[model samples]
Target: MRKLVAFEHMTVDGYAASAEGLGFEFTWRAYSEELSAYGDEHIRADVDTALYGRATYLGMRDYWSAVPDDPAASQHEQVHAEWVNGVEKIVFSTTLESAGWTNARVIGSDVEAQVRALKAGPGGTMQIYASPKLVHSFVGLGLIDEFRIVLHPGTLGAGTPLFPDKSALDLDLVESKAFASGAVYLRYRVA
Candidate 1:
């Protein structure tokens, strides 16, 4: 069986985005060497595929496929980009006609059923990226097996929230790590 996990960055107040998505003023605060390395190893060691919604998929496709091979690009950045470009990507989107990435497949409907089949099959860890809509569906539909989030410190005066609506969930704290970058990484097993 495959485990479905969500990897998200949230504010201290638990909002995933500040009005718009991960850009503009709300861009990733600062890159921590420790945290970035941890994230890279976390994915390289276990995760084999990425699950995304239309927006996240497109954004990632554009960004990762173009990690510049220049002096400005760090070794970590180049390696991370290569990892993303190599991994399989499954996108759930009704409006998207074709997957922009070669390693990507688009599912227009019956998302839950298809995802269930994916989980039933033999596979490595599947990580859901920055897609709040997909996250909401996976959580509310009781499909996700684990939730891993990095909680950054700050209160976005207003923005898209991680959990906009309240739904009772029973979860066990599987792991927690605090970084010198004022970020706390948390992993929870859905119960």
Candidate 2:
């Protein structure tokens, strides 16, 4: 069986986004070279399938797809963008009519069944990116095999949290690395 990993950048308070809303704006304060390299390494070494909700899928498609064409883009950014562009991207949504990016497709319904089938099939690690609602659902269903989180030093205080309020998960720490910027990368296997 393939591993289903939920990757998230979270505040110390456990929020994935600010109380204002869910987007890229709230999570980059503690970004560092170590964190960036770690992300790229994970993508290169572990992930072959990327999972996202409609909003995140659209956002990532726009950003990563354009990185290769940007003259000012760094080698790191270009390489990661290339990997993202080639990987199988599965967008989970009911309203998204199409996945316009390359190697991308839309799974409009039957999330639980489809996801289970994906996990059961042959593949590299499947990573769920910046989709808190989808992550929560996966967690609730006991579908996530691993949790890889970059915990920023500060707190959002109020925002879209990473986990559901009433649910509980038992996890075993697999790895932990602290970056110079006070950000910490934690990897846990669901127990």
Candidate 3:
């Protein structure tokens, strides 16, 4: 069975994004390093698909698809662009008519069932990035297998939290790495 991995950046205070959804203040400079570790080679070897929410998919598709190939492009950006454009992406949205990115599709049916079916299918692993709402839903369904969280040092007093409502989740720490920038990468498996 393929595993479902949730990857996100969260502040020390647990906010993933601002209330207005304008900024991802939880993101730190070390995030680039963490992301770069999942370059084309790693993604091609491990990740077979991507699951994203409407808002995240739209924003990422627009930005990554429009990025030009220039000398100024950072290695992480170039690798990310390649991975985003090459991998298969499923956008779960109720209002989206169509997806703009290549190898991307819009799913409008039962989210949890579809995701479970996808995990049961023959594949490597499906990765979900920066979709806190979807993550919470999946967590409730006990569909997510692993969580790869990049925790920044700063705190947002009030904003959109990583977890939605109060819920009990028993997790076992799989691995952890701390960077010089006070950003820690923590990997946990659902226990």
Best to worst by TM-score, what's the order? Answer: 2, 1, 3
Cα lDDT of model 1 by residue, 1-191, tens digit? 99999888888777776775453244356448988988887634689989998887888888788885556788988888888888999999999989878688999899889999999998899999878778988888888888888888777877666764886788899989888878788988988
lDDT for each residue of candidate 2 in 6-94, tens digit (9 for 90 to 100) = 99988888898675644546556778777788878763378899999888888899989999999999988888888899999999999
What's the lDDT for all of these models? 0.81, 0.87, 0.79
Pairs in clash, predicted candidate 3: none
lDDT value for model 3: 0.79
Among these predicted structures, which one has the highest lDDT?
2
Per-residue lDDT of 28-121 in model 3, one digit per residue for the tens? 4555665457434443357879888888888888888866566677867786788788889999899998987899999888987888888888
- In the order shown, the candidates' Cα RMSDs to the true structure are 1.8, 1.4, 2.3
Worst-scoring 10-residue span by lDDT in model 2: 19-28
The better-scoring model by lDDT among 1 and 2 is: 2
TM-score pick, better of 1 and 3 = 1
The number of the candidate with the highest TM-score is 2
Residue 4 CA displacement from its true place in model 1, Å: 0.4
Candidate 3: clashing residue pairs, number: 0
TM-score of each: 0.93, 0.95, 0.89
